[model samples]
Target: MSSQSSTQGAALAPEKRETFSSRKLFILSAIGSAVGLGNIWRFPYVAYENGGGAFLIPYIVAIFCAGIPLLFLDYAIGHRYRGSAPLSYRRANRKTEIIGWWQVLICFVIAIYYAAIIAWAAMYCWYSVTKAWGNDAEGFFYGEFLNTADTVGVSFDFVPNVFFPMLIVWIFTIVIMVAGVNKGIARANAVFMPLLIVMFLILVVQSVFLPGAIDGLNAFFTPNFDALQNPAVWAAAFGHIFFSLSVAFGIMVTYSSYMKRKSDLTGSGYVVALANSSFEILAGIGVFAALGFMAYNANSSVDSVVSGGIGLAFIAFPTIVSAAPFGALIGVLFFGSLVFAGLTSLISILEVIVAAFQDKLGWGRVKATLIVSIPVAVVSLLLFSATTGIYLLDTIDAFVNQFGILACALVMVIVFGSGLGMLPKLAKHLNRHSSIKLGTGWMVLVGGIGPAVLAYMLINEFQAKITEQYSGYPAWFNGVFGWGLCGLLIVVAGLISLIPWSKNSKLEDPEYDQHQQNVQAEAVPETVSKEY
Candidate 1:
């Protein structure tokens, strides 16, 4: 597994893996993944609640201190090893492969429900034109659209509205997955990221022109400098940025694995991080401007109109669309942005799962895409398209994202940075080809600051979730689907990691030989262009 030869296992798997043709595509794809539903819906409220403008202080600190460092950590491993998350970690050191599988499982869980939100947004894009959720947006979203049951239990009673759209979303996802990385992911990001930016910009411009729009913008931008003294506000900045950039997950790792060996790993990371943060700030502007208009219309304060996550996307935004003039345009743009952002993120999440199987089972891209995606699509449809879906989605999302990501990330940096003693090796690998060379400070950031912050976040989340049923969901519901599902993922990850890697995957990575030689030589790669 240490060295690779093209001819070493010709019969096992003949197809060579794909790579992004340029640094530009990789940066675009990475940004597409980072700037997702969270950037649009979550960041605006987080910043508003955290300290308004002052949140940027910790947000930027968290970026340099934690976000970018972990991002580079993912890049160094994936690009240096030139394989999927499992293969990359296995090649790095065998003991660390389980961490990769844990991330893969987390992505699988996220992708399934993530599609439902995208489907909902896609439907809202149409509903915006029709003014579908008339009279009562809240009742329409829950009682009518989702059709909540009296109790928290699964049912076959599918809502045709949700079912059809979700089915369409899954089919679109399946097609994209089958198209392979370059024709599919790269091209999709190429199109969707630009479209998302343009649509959101138009939406923001329109919202800014609305009556009382300045009230929302002022509420969002006016910094409560006093709030900076609160530890929770600082934690909020770190937490939001931690999630915003999509680092330490299997996503960045898998995406980076597709980059060329001599690529500018760090430089591309900085670009992705910057674009992601900038988009989040822009989203805050648009969302709160709309919120300000909503508050003005309702004769209430901006604080009363503020909401985040599902409430912001489905309820609050829908209310804004209904009340404001040119509301239909607002609805289409806002919901349309969600669809674009969610779809791009959904693609990246599924790639983590598909790439893992491709490497582990020695399957070609088409075979792996079909084999991995179809069953997942079926499961996603069954779970998320029914009346019971909202409860399951809410509970599972809280558990996996709030608990799973931080837990896996903490274990990742600790295991890779310490247990395997791979940080020094990884740091060297990064500096060899990257434009901005890393030093001990980067290492310290990844090893020391990253873990401490993650540990603190994990402890706080655990205390909060464990202390009470999350979101006032029933204890049985939280226990089985929340804590129980999280526990199940780790168990599943350990078992999956025990499986033997196929000959083609573990035995045949020709570029990996060049990588090891580069590490041994400790010089710039021969493939490196004069640009560096």
Candidate 2:
């Protein structure tokens, strides 16, 4: 066989291949990573908070205009380079790889807190089966999960049960990575994703049957033009689209690096977007419908029944589930689906860290996975500590998800969208075989409008912090903790950027001859040669 065909065929062999993800498997795994608890638990609340049904306007627009283009960009970059985010970014543009590292850094922070949240979901799943959460759903959660007193005073508690489950989660993640992609991640997604969809459909059906469901549905779908007119609402909608789709982060880049050359990224991009948005719509229907029922029964506004943070899941969801027929069964299924979703995403995030370790430190995949898992596991153990531990998790989650991600995303836009002269090259590659070709229009969006909006969001986010510090918190606690944490993260990221290793890095420019040779080798027709 020709050298190129030989490599392609070798990739199919289980024993010889280093990374064994197929085009089919890549798509499935990508879908699994993208569709998660965020779609079910978070999106509903965000949709409700923003503009209700009116949110869909900006949301749909963002998907096409922003989300899909970025998704394809990551895929094209990754598949072409056949490396993880750090390597892909460096391979694309050596100097610009620093920006990619920033994205990787964000994923690392997210993995710490994200795993904790997943642990919470696993705990809920266990409780569902054990019936530990009795009919007094809200009380059980607040008393057991959210309220504990220790040195930190009244705060959340990290039970041993929660921590142990997280260990299982970490183990599960490593095993999937060890399985070499196709057999592990792909097979897992093939099984779990369908189950997620089925459960969602069943919940939607059940929710619609609940009395006052229409009121919730109407509230969710009905556009509030007033809210739509607000620029902040539009920004929120766009940001949610970006965050929920898992763009800006290097996860998509890493995942796509495993794709076969012939993979139709534009087609797969559409599939991922459709599947993701459908989950959001389904989640909105499920959540608001349940809220509508709750409102009708309680004779109050839906807002009264709503709560934020983990309370929404641990408290509000369980309360809603208890009122339904076969409550325990449904609760089990819902939380089970959540565990699956979170696990899938967690695996992708951890893979980014593992890949970086392997590329930078020259460690083998197994060694890298184990090495990364150890420190993460050790830190994650803190989440099991008494009251103080839970507070740390909350603070970490907010700081990382809100600030770190936004910061990394802005840097990525600046680097990929502006710093490196890859926009024209990217547009050309994206347009080459793409059914929906992205062009100069996308360049303007990513380089100009996208960055401006991301900057505005970051500023607003920090301003919100300031407002909360001065006016929202108690005098003693004001500005002390929150600002300190934010400042620390900033310092850490800045120090990372200054490291000598990043200063002289050389990234392979995608438009260069070497890159073209690599792409041509991979994309060559199967019938062209079989002689090696």
Please give the CA lDDT of all the candidate structures. Answer: 0.88, 0.71
For 234-284, candidate 1 gives per-residue lDDT tens digits of: 888889888889987789989998998778888889999999999998999
Residue 336 displacement in candidate 2 (angstroms) = 1.4
Q: What is the C-alpha RMSD of each candidate to the true structure, in Å?
A: 3.6, 5.4
TM-score of each: 0.95, 0.86
Which pairs clash (backbone N, Cα, C closer than 3 Å) in model 2?
1-530, 1-531, 1-532, 2-530, 2-531, 94-507
Total clashes, candidate 2? 6
Worst window of 10 by summed lDDT in candidate 2: 502-511
Residue 279 in candidate 1 has what lDDT?
93
Task: Please give the lDDT score at residue 513 for candidate 2.
Answer: 47
For candidate 2, give the lDDT.
0.71
Off by over 4 Å in 2: 1-21, 129-131, 150-158, 470-532
lDDT of 2 by residue, 422-515 (tens): 7677666555555665667878887887788789989988787666544333434433334555556556645554454422122333233454
Worst 10 residues of 1 by lDDT: 523-532
